[model samples]
Target: MQPAAPESAAPAAFSYTAFALSLIAGLALGIALGRLLGPLPGGEAEPWQLRAEDRNHYMLAIALEYHESGDAARALDKLIALKPAGDPLVALAEGACALGSGGYLADASGIAALRSAVQLYQDFGREGCAERLLPEAAPAALPAEPPPPAADARAQPTPLPSKTPPPASAQTAQTARLAPTPLPRRFREHSLRSFCDIARPAIIEVRTVDYLGRGVPGQRIRVRWGESEDIFLTGIKREYGDNYGDFQMEEGVEYAVDMPGAAEPLATALSTGSCYSDNRRGLKSWRVSFVEV
Candidate 1:
């Protein structure tokens, strides 16, 4: 009798949180750097003298373009070695990238986020726009706004609730409980917000191809994930799936698969998130399987 064949390893489960973050980081880095350089969608390889016309989004798009090729880990090296304060695109993409890379939102605050966006907007208009977008009075941390007091005349001044502080024991217990939680094991690590952030820095384009070495046109492949029943992000798979894999990218959408072998999906199944990704790139887990003619 023939010897039994070795079983294949089970595919790694994909983490929505992890991969999303990678893409975010990748795009942000790429954009920030590209913007610092100039006119980068396809203009010059690395623009030196920055132009006044360069938008904050230009470089971010470039980074997304970088991810279009997939492989976040590789893209990360490019991001780590950057000096991005001078350019607006660099700043904004870097901020959003935290979520795209999908692990930790890191230490950036909401005020920082709005400030970055505002700064870029300022570049477009003048001091007026900057005043509105990034107001001088804005708090550094920019905590959420407080609720307004009631205006009804009939509403007698209700007795204000007394501030009852928690017992010292309770406070100490809470602190102790939180202290033992490690960085990787925290609940915040697994949230959707963090996941999307991490993947942003890691996503690449998903192109399609056929058995032959020619570009496959107009074929729509669905990107489904094995980890969850939901489709990862199903969009019109790219047109230039030849060099890449059967796929094309939608603008702004990034694809990420922490689930190794979760790459190069074979068939579409309902369950995972089904939608289009920015038509630029994707990362492959499974070997590309071209549709046979």
Candidate 2:
């Protein structure tokens, strides 16, 4: 009886505990992996990413600093990195770098860059900067030197065949069309100063309102000077003002501002009659309110 029947082992109960543990582990792993590959907190972008305007402004600063440091090569590199290769500011910087690279205005690259910058500035309503780069209109052509007094045939030295072709200096001068010439140090200093002057910010403000005296946002303002016109939009800039936009105005220049929604265009006089204390130098502005025509 004791040996009776080896008690049949009770069928092993299905392990719910093990199955639950495995499922929990899988879920934990999935969560960890998702977090590891997920985007950064706050969904932020790479810090290195730069906006076009920001990049342009940064390069201008670096280029200007390099010019002052007399580091022409570095200045040029900064300009080359600038976007919109056709930007007048970039062209101006390139021209300045070329000129400061011990070539003065004789440097062909510098002259070309300056010419391009001048045209772009004109097209962009930057007359002050453009005017500075343009050559004086109708500059008198230099008189041609009289032909070398006819050398007496007897006085001319007989040409002797040389085994070696020519001196290195003479060969270089003959082969290279653009030889680097030494520029006076003072000239570079002057050029850097002029660049600073031209590149400095001269902020101009505009505010638009409707006849009901309500601020008008998204109004397009066309600023005209000389033969150039530039359009900008109005927005609310914090406490600066609602329906406001700002532009940089060249010193001592007048501009005509037209708003399509306004009854009439506003013309800036010698004095806009309104100036503000802004970080930018020579801050001026115009306040326009539309009225029933």
Off by over 4 Å in 1: 1-206, 226-289
TM per candidate comes to 0.16, 0.27
Which numbered prediction scores highest in lDDT against the true structure? 2
Candidate 1 matches the true fold with a TM-score of 0.16
Displacement of the residue 122 alpha carbon in candidate 2, Å: 31
Root-mean-square deviation of every model = 27.8, 19.2
State the displacement of the C-alpha of residue 48, model 2, in Å, after optimal TM-score superposition: 25
Q: Candidate 2's error at 265, in angstroms? A: 1.6
Tens-digit lDDT track of model 1 for 156-215: 776554334345575465344321212211010011221122233323333333445343
Model 2: clashing residue pairs? none
lDDT of each: 0.35, 0.45
